[model samples]
Target chain A: MARTLINLPKTAKAGAVIEIKTLISHPMETGYRPGPEGRLVPRDIITEFVCRFEGEEVFRAELFPATSANPYLTFTTLAERSGTFTFTWTGDNGFSQTESAALTVT
Target chain B: MRRALLGLLLLAVPAAAEIAPGERRSGFDQMTPELRAMQTDEAANPGQLWVGDGEEAWAAAPPTGRPACAGCHGAVATMRGVAARYPAWDEAAARPVDLQGRINLCRTRHQGADPLPFESRPLLALTAAVAAQSRGLPVAPPADPRLDPARAEGERLFTRRTGQLDLACAQCHDALWGRRLGASTIPQGHPNGYPLYRLEWQDLGSLQRRLRNCLTGMRAEPYPFGAPEYLALELHLMRRAQGLAIEAPAVRP
Candidate 1:
């Protein structure tokens, strides 16, 4: 299930400022419920998120226990470089998700 | 300003008893024997946290020097038949008393302890134990005319219009019977087995709790805890499910 929404600006100037936002829907449960085997479910959550442009890391975040269920993020970026920006979420239980969008600098 | 204030007021009511999230799952008619067995096991085990507390309440004598129903009633079996006949006409009081009221009476008059809050753990457990005693007994409303008024009140609540959803309680549970609202299916809304541990909630909740869910599902402002409206509805639904087995801790989507 793709939890995030990615919206790219239609176009951008070479040095123009650009904004991007993302939101994901998840319970992000605290693993408080005992599993079928009576063992507490491991704390599998999105602990890391990274956004990169043209192979350069533009933004990074380290999530903690307090991060609420539906996480949302917005940030400003420069259109000085034109290429694809990739977003990824990494966590326990091999949970991984990736999304990408392209920008053209003129 | 008037419109905005009205909207805010409307929002406040729904906010109090809002369903945590998502739609109430439907399709509850499909239950296998394995699922039924699982339900039995869950019910047999003491309810999470609450049951243990109730056991303590029952065994410990209060300082007020009131008689202990426990010393006489002993276990649920002794009082099971009593519940199935409740909200009945008490010729003495000449008015109806729901289970919560009755529990309060015992605590205040006989148990020597203060009455627990309507939706609190102690109250729920006491009600649970008392209601459990009537496990196999059929719901039998008192034949006296006194109950007619309360039952009429409940029926009115079930059909009343409310909320942004523009729904009445029966519009779905009664009119749309056997329909799917989302991932889960809906069954005939019955209260035979309450204090149920619904799978969707992943916790044991009272029928009133479920009513809160319904009010939220329909986007209506829910009545406050221990509200008269909810008690009336409870009485009505319990009577409706009269012939059905009391299946507390029952699983629902």
Candidate 2:
């Protein structure tokens, strides 16, 4: 399970590109860090992220071990109409999270 | 340029009898350039989320009959430079009060609203909002004579070793400053970037939270939140950080 935050403008002009910011809390363990007993911490991180607006794909990204903890992603998409924007993240250890926010284009 | 020359002069003219010089550099100065850049970019700093929430909270009236903070204060911009002068001596209370205490005082006395718990999200948000208003202002606690006793007590507490590890705040933050403690460098331990978003915490937190973490690391029992000891320590820390720019809602690793 992951804690997520999604930021989207409450309203935007029709056809205007609006910025969307999302942050997910994940350790993004690189597997290189040493644990208390000198053992390597297991690697875990969100590997894929996808965003959809009005059921249509808008943005996508592939994350890696090099990604920092609490991965933050910001992107812009054209606001076509008043609708919901959905975000999904999948990663190691069978981790997955989904969150959505509503936006209105006046 | 003149400030740099003054700094050099101060360094050259050291006096054993003079009071210890305050830290000139901020913890932000020790950060990697990329991390520094993130803090500089308001859009990128995660702390801004709480600040945004704080802005809303300032305008929202609770169940109490009193008006919202915005109703009285008008614009948040007017609050600029206010946080930098906190831990001020409250004559009515006859003691020093930090920003958090001041907020709670307003809530109970003026708004008739119950005081928010320390470290609570609502409290942190409001504190962050007030602190955000003072961003970039120099930390300048009032020069009230009554605070001297508490300042001295705080200074003693800072140097007096305690806890299972027998460590004091000065041990790592002062004597070992600029040295590496594992992957992180020991900072001068100023209170400038309070209510900052520490990546280690993965959320916005108060200075008290950080201090508690330190005490825990030392195997020391932490004082309950809002304890007078913490306020005294805060007053001392603020004085130590005098002239340092406030970077509230700052980001850190």
Candidate 3:
């Protein structure tokens, strides 16, 4: 399983906008770097990230080779009700991981 | 008579120039506000990835089925303040062993596993994880008589000039710290933070790696990883950094 860190308030007021931050461990190796034999290191990068609240999509991003190693992302989402936030990252070589955190709207 | 007195005063200058213990500053203090923020925020610090990996490794059993580190050491939290006393003297080796050395020793002797290569992800992850447990504790090198000789040798290495640049660690870190070195300010070169995430490398790394980088930058042949000289130097550094808080997994530019 990919190591990930997610930051969000455990509770938020209804209609309030809350910030969410995430970081995941991945080399995100761009194909440009050379190896010991001076051959290009093959490209490996996370291509997509999506977050859903109560099973409805809230935020999404399409990543590229330019993204750094251990990709970190921060965004804001509206809190409408108490639910779980599920985060998914899909990448090259069939690498995909899904993790979730719960939030309460009161 | 005046000339003789002036010569004596000149002889005293270098000794007096060493930074006083009360004045010592951590690399953390020298960082840009953004980098400091990055180090403080767990969610944003890239080093946390390694710590997370380490937490897993602590409990994982190798294919050989030997006990995991946690089996003997208990919870990782129990390791609090342990890193502060590293580069401690080892009776079995009759030499000093830094935190990484101790970890590798455990794998080989206790777990019956091959030692992980230096700079490898597994090694960095585990070292960072272990050091993170001591994050807020003051570095307290054990008062072991056996460590005295190694610490002395380390002090010599720190002050001795070599390499194409003909510089000693003290020339910059001790005498000229807080001064500008090209585009960056020279830091005091304390080891309070090890296994930190340097933005320039875009990866987590150990203190030995950082020291080697400095050696190479001076146009000197860096000793191979796990060299005794490096361990001696680490012992001295921890002693020199006494009372400084550990900041392993710190972020740096």
Whole-model lDDT per candidate: 0.67, 0.85, 0.91
Show where candidate 1 strays beyond 4 Å.
A1-106, B1-29, B32-34, B42-56, B89-94
Model 2 clashing-pair count: 0
Compare the candidates by DockQ and give the number of the best one.
Answer: 3
Worst 10 residues of 2 chain B by lDDT: B14-23
- TM-score winner between candidates 1 and 3: 3
Please, what is the TM-score per model?
Answer: 0.59, 0.74, 0.93
**Poorest 10 consecutive residues by lDDT, candidate 1 chain B:** B18-27
Calculate DockQ per candidate and list them. 0.01, 0.16, 0.91
TM-score, predicted candidate 3 vs. hidden true structure: 0.93
TM-score of chain A of each: 0.83, 0.95, 0.97
Q: Quote the positional error of residue B57 for candidate 1 in Å.
A: 2.7
Interface RMSD for candidate number 2?
3.9
The alpha-carbon RMSD values of the candidates against the true structure, listed in the order shown, are 20.8, 7.3, 3.6
lDDT of 2 by residue, B1-253 (tens): 9999999888767322222565367889999999998788766787777787788889998787689998889877788988998888887889888888888988988899999998888898889999998988999988999998988788777877989999998888767888999899988888998899898877788888998998898899998888887887888888888899999999889
User: Where does candidate 3 clash, by residue pair?
Assistant: none
B83, model 1: CA deviation in Å? 3.1
Candidate 2 overall lDDT versus native: 0.85
Point to the candidate with the largest lDDT: 3
Candidate 3 lDDT over A5-106, as tens digits, reads 999999999999999999998989888999999999999999999999878999999999988888999999998899999999999999999999999999
lDDT of 2 at B77: 76
- The C-alpha stretches of model 2 lying farther than 4 A from their native spots are A1-56, A61-71, A75-106, B1-23
